[model samples]
Target: MVKSRSETRAHILETAARLLDDEGAAALTIRAVAQAAGLQAPALYRFFEDKDALLDAVAEHVFTTYVTGKAAARDGDPVADLRAGWDAHIGFGVANAALFGLLVTPGRTSPVAEAGLVVLRARVHRIAEAGRLRVPERLAAELVHAAGTGAVLTLLARRPEDRDPGLAEAMFEAVLARILTDAPTPTDTSPDLSKLTVAERALLAEWLDRD
Candidate 1:
């Protein structure tokens, strides 16, 4: 039975995504995908020109879903916007750890990466503009993503017996608060070291003495 072009494309993407989620992105291959989809290896060529093309399609699918959901969750306030985005971003990573891992890992360039960067820049710029941050919006977005990913990695690395969902959520919230609040304000005056306690001064001196 001959399948329609859309059906074939959908099957390929579904198969690829499953492979990505179940076995990591490195396991993705035309032959494996075709076998998973119950199609001959040549049939995959009709949907994707090569393995990179197939991977691009899967990345696009995952990223589009992510970006769209994030966009929908945005509210007008910049602080609130940042909070919501961080929460959703971390939540996605926790829920879809394999897919999230695949998306962020260094790999071939694709439109999926481009699309994610575009949306993230826009969101980060909106927040940075509100705060008059000196760093570029893209840099801010990259930092935010890196921090969130680090937290997710910590959560994922926990042993199954030691994993506590509530504790992880609380820790994520704590980290987000520190990131948003402790970040320097461009025009804010630097605090005087003279005002610190003796212990604080010693700690500061120790830090300053570090290479």
Candidate 2:
């Protein structure tokens, strides 16, 4: 059966991603991808010009998924939110080390990667607005970005069994020490509304914010 353009493109990306995972990025040649995806080599050019272009698309496709889900989930506490983002970033990087390596290559640029940064910056900005962030918002964001990326790369470089289990969290705490103010951030003193439905809790928060 013939597939829609998008469906066909998605199939190619999935097949390429599987190849990348199984055999590394070096195995993602257009011919290899075309064969694995069950399409003629020439048919791939309609979706991607060459191996590099295809790799770029695959990185965006994969990172876009990680960034989307990361952005959707949140911790009410700004500090915890930042930590959660750090954890998620590290997890994604280590899990998809091959694609993550492509992502952080010098001079590489990606909208999905930028979106992840946007989410991190927004989380930092929240702390700054609350007077709990010691550093400038941009600097704080950069610090977190650099440190998180570095932590992931470092862990990826190590043998899985040899990796320090606490390394990522330690890096996060170090960045936090530099960025967060001495004054403790406020706790969620708001009454527990666990009994309320999700929609009801959202409505209540919306009402509270309006006051």
Candidate 3:
């Protein structure tokens, strides 16, 4: 049966991702991917501009799938949600080192990555609203992002047997220690607003207890 354009593109991406996982990026070639997908090399250009473009798409495919799966797993408190995001990012980078490399290539901005930063920003914003954040929201988000990326890349550099399982969590804790505060904000201790309706009071309590 003939495939639609989107279906063909998804098939090509899935095939390329399999090859990337089996062999490192250095060994991946357009011809190989096309052959694996049972398509002529020229046909692949219908969906991708070139090998580099194909790799970028594959990176997006895998990383977006990983993030979507994580999002559906479960919800949590603010701090737990932040840690979950950190762990998911590190896990994806390490598990898909070659694709991760493409996603975070210097001088190349990925929309998928920017979306991830948006999630991080939201998570940090939640903590800030809860009065658990000690630093600025932007700074807190960047710290978590930088730390997660560095930890994953550093671990990927090592032989799997030589990698420390605790390193990623330790880096997360270090970032958290620098950013989180236990003290409540001034408004938390302010005089109660008896004039507030029940619904407003409940919403305010939910926001304050987010951490």
Candidate 4:
């Protein structure tokens, strides 16, 4: 009864991610992961050379997943793309609350950090280009990302009884609106708002006018 290499690796990664979400990164020790995965400590070494390797793998997975989903949301219209992206970000953050917090928290850094930032910047460019985002798109993206990330982190930080689901969703929607309206965009060139159909422009204008 021998597990294939891929199977062993998958089990270890899944077990490690779950432990990280449940108990913070501290619970991802080799022994704990091994016990949780029903494998011995020595068996863990076959998948991950050490805890650093495992943590890096976890960070990479989280980063890649978030970036990929966000990039895919940048479809046709910038406004629609951004709106969809905002929803996706909120959903992912809420669903993977602990892991999302862990990956974004201030103090921790892993091998995935640099690569993640690079990918994030590229995604920002896509949204900025489509939306004709004003200010500086990169700066705007950073701010929007920070606010969105912060909201999710704070929500998860609260006690279970204190959590307010509706309030959180509303807050995200409100912040997203603000970010779209006021965040940096390409101001040097005149925006092609006319590219929108009459009905589309009217709807956009109405949305822009809302408080």
Candidate 4: give the clashing pairs. 133-184, 133-185, 133-186, 134-184, 134-185, 135-184, 135-185
Q: Candidate 2's residue-wise lDDT over 1-211, tens digit each? A: 8899999999999999989988987888999999999999999999987777898899888877777776646768888888877878898999898888877888977666777788888999888877798778999999999999999999999999999999999988999899988885676788878899999999998998994
Q: What is the lDDT of residue 49 in candidate 2?
A: 78
lDDT of 2 at 14: 91
How much does candidate 3 score in TM-score? 0.80
- List of clashing residue pairs for candidate 1: none
> lDDT, candidate 3, residue 61?
91
Cα lDDT, model 1, residue 210: 100
TM-score of each: 0.69, 0.80, 0.80, 0.67
Question: How do the residues 1-211 of candidate 3 rate in per-residue lDDT, one tens digit apiece?
Answer: 9999999999999999999988878756889999999999999988889887887788789987887776745355788889888888888898888888877789888777778899889988988888888889999998898899899989999999999999999999999899998675655567567989999999989998998
Instruction: Flag the better candidate by TM-score, 2 or 4.
Output: 2
Clashing pairs counted in every model: 0, 0, 0, 7
The TM-score measured for candidate 1 stands at 0.69
lDDT of 1 by residue, 7-54 (tens): 879878887888888887678889999999898999889878998788
Q: Residues 52-116, candidate 4: write the lDDT tens digits.
A: 78887876776566667656634665555555655666667777766676667688776665564
RMSD, every candidate, angstroms: 11.9, 11.8, 8.6, 11.4
Lowest summed lDDT over 10 consecutive residues: which window, candidate 3? 183-192
| Candidate 3 stretches greater than 4 Å from native | 68-76, 188-211
User: In model 2, what are the clashing residue pairs, if there are any?
Assistant: none
